[model samples]
Target: MARGPVGQITRGTTGTNRLRRVDRWIARHPALRRAADPLVVDLGYGASGVTALELHARLARARPDVEVLGLEIDPERVSRARAQLELVRAGGASFAPDARVSFARGGFEVPVPGGRRPAVIRAFNVLRQYDEAEVPDAWSTMAARLSPDGLLVEGTCDEIGRIATWVAVGTDAAPRTLTVSLRLAGLQHPSIAAERLPKALIHHNVPGERVHAFLGALDSEWERAASVSPFGPVHRWRTALSALVDAGWPVRERSRWRLGEVTVPWEAVAPG
Candidate 1:
């Protein structure tokens, strides 16, 4: 007697630790820290539920009462995740036996039990296959299911998660910021994230768009910081980001630069 999921099934491509970058960012976000209910939704959690389990483990460090519900439109995927959860409960999986994580068949509708709105909904790699015009509707659908102060992180990452970029959307369905996270050890240029830009900005990374200009600035600063390469990639990244701030790029959370992340207000890179 359950209602059908509201979205289409995706390619379901996912991997272990593939979403680590965004998960780390979420761990420190104020939205999760101040949530009264602390319920998180891993919308369209792909072929496997491992990322959702990982999210629970990581976020639990910030709020022990946090609960994670992994939702998938594919019932077969849900069945697989439930099987994995059973392994965890039986002491045969990497996750804690008591980890507050569960899997269900759902999509943008975010059908949580008892009609509870979530504090955060992460829809990574979920909209990559959809048309650009479809994105706003999808964003609105998910954002509508959030708590008053909830966050909707929708974006993409590379195969091994070295490069990731995400858009932080609020309950109003308006994107607030765009964050690019990289593994600085061997990073060639910060512009590498340009390839992984979130769906909303990917097609807009042209000469006239704000995101393109921002990437251009990032690459220019990276080249200018070449002298800092002797210090280490982290120092070089820090220098490049400092240059952006100096150029009035509206960067946020400067402290996270050390972790190879740079977040800019969405207005700084939103499509023109």
Candidate 2:
């Protein structure tokens, strides 16, 4: 509770590709798609910098010359990641060439070295440690650090990257949409995403909130679509999503739903 030694140390749990879904999503985002200089921030990358490195490599496929910086509140963790990246760079693996993906020490302030506002900021599993009441302020602080055409993607995910939900925000600090991505092969119910919702919507999964109503409707649709389960969970999920749209949920597209993801306009399920 003290001040966290210059920057707050998070739970520090991380693994390879633990944030792949979000990374893939960011790669295709219109903000990063048209950026002249695609600078991205991996805020609170936990004990390891693997997720940051992975994000750089993944985005490079689309942006070709994307820059990623991993920021951690714990100096020790940052030092560890810096050493690993140095070793990789010495080996000539272009994944982190010229230190395009590097580590630093910072908190919600997002202290980028040269005071550069990044085009995209991805903070996965960072705010889940804070009280829900603190989410909006955190979102504001991070969003304000984005470039005029930037986006802030903040979310939570399971360690294995099985389920994830993130809110994409514009530079004005307004959340645009919430996206839920999961593996549909064995998905029981869409609401299972509640466990991994971003700090903003995690607590709002209770009664009387739009998110609560949204999940409730998803459960209902999933039940109605159970007949399709014999074909496969994926088929059942698609059916459930169709049912949701019929029920007027303002669902995104079948293309995304086929990939086990569903995005809704922010106002649709935003907290009241």
Candidate 3:
């Protein structure tokens, strides 16, 4: 395999199932469900390969033939992931023996074997360390390596993965939508997701910015929906999201909003 451009090395702080929310979202994505090549890339899966293994397990439920490749810029991490794969193969781990997953040392270039581009690339918490100005170029580089109908899901989440936000970027490298997913049971406020916004808009969550206005609206709706909290957080959240849609926020479908999730077109919340 040709050496790709070396990207930044993250803290590699990975925890088991830390990416469940995003993985679930990706599993249900139409692009992956309908892809001719069901290859997914877990870009920068940290210190351990468990997240990649979990990704394979989760996505395999939707596409039994799905393949996952865990890419890390650090060679040591790649070697360690391969060792974990060996354990999985030997029945010493939770992953199935036939889990179609692999590890490689790669970065933004997304060097896949035989020049096969992936249908989906999940780059969670990868861009958090870079300057916001670099996000566009980084996104463009990865998007260029996608298959015809590929998707790039990039974002950040807390250490244990309760609250999360991600930007869905199309092959053109332009963000299509931004999704904020929270575990409503303990959600303090919908606007807390401002902290987990994708790198592109995290710093833009300030006065006069579109993202700021969006979050403010969400918080306001959350407060307005407080009367429904007697029913449940889920119902309260659904109500708030409905209010957002009613307020012309262009929120996505109710199916997603039901899961403590809300997505809006990038234009609705893009950085000003």
Candidate 4:
């Protein structure tokens, strides 16, 4: 069989906790917990495999038997990751077999060794370099490799992961939800999230776009709730999100908002 296209290598400047929000989200995903075949793939996990290792450690909390594989197109990057794993193991690190969080040389073709289909594929910051037109096909190709009930989480985030957004996609490659996660301590306006939206919504942030209106409403509410800023940043966010719901924005939950995140059904923000 012919190997798939080996895309351009990313800058690969990864760091610890740079993908924590997505990791936390994946760990709590129902599919990850209940998968009879709990295999997750971290596609294009940059120069360092720290994110993959961290993902394994966190997701294991929900499914201790889960297997996490990090795939990269760069062979040298894979070798370096293997060396890091060895050092971690020699230091009495707690991780599954070397197989649990192993690195593989592959591209979006998602060549899982032994042809294993993944239950969850976290491809953060992987498609930022590709044209937005390529996103849908890429999503389709990856979701096709799911083990029945799989999820393809594709999105981007700032370097430190404080401002992040992702689209949760089902096995059929249909987007189900849009989640915006941030570090709310210094939040100026929800529009700041516009800078971090996934590929689909990034270019749609203009008049006549649902995402644009959603963000506009959020910014308006944030200002209207400025009176509560004295109470605290969290209080202000809660007030703004409350206004969003009151304004029929269909915001997700207060609990999630309190954690510097809010998820909306994809229908609410899907392109017109």
Candidate lDDT (C-alpha), each: 0.93, 0.86, 0.93, 0.86
Q: For residues 1-272, write the lDDT of model 4, one tens digit per residue.
A: 97654566777878888999888888888889889889999899989888899999899888888888888888899999888788777764555444367888877777787878999999989888888898888888888888898899999999888989999999899999999988888877788889888998899999999999888998899899999988998888888888888888887745677778889999999999
- Backbone N/Cα/C clashes per model: 0, 0, 0, 0
Write down the TM-score of every candidate. 0.98, 0.92, 0.98, 0.94
The candidate with the higher lDDT, 1 or 2, is: 1
The C-alpha stretches of model 3 lying farther than 4 A from their native spots are 1-4
Q: Could you tell me which residue pairs clash in candidate 2?
A: none
* Model 2 accuracy (lDDT, Cα): 0.86
RMSD of each: 1.1, 2.7, 1.2, 1.9
Which ranges of candidate 2 are over 4 A from the true structure?
Answer: 1-7, 92-99
Pairs with backbone N, CA or C atoms under 3 Å apart (clashes), candidate 3: none
lDDT of 1: 0.93
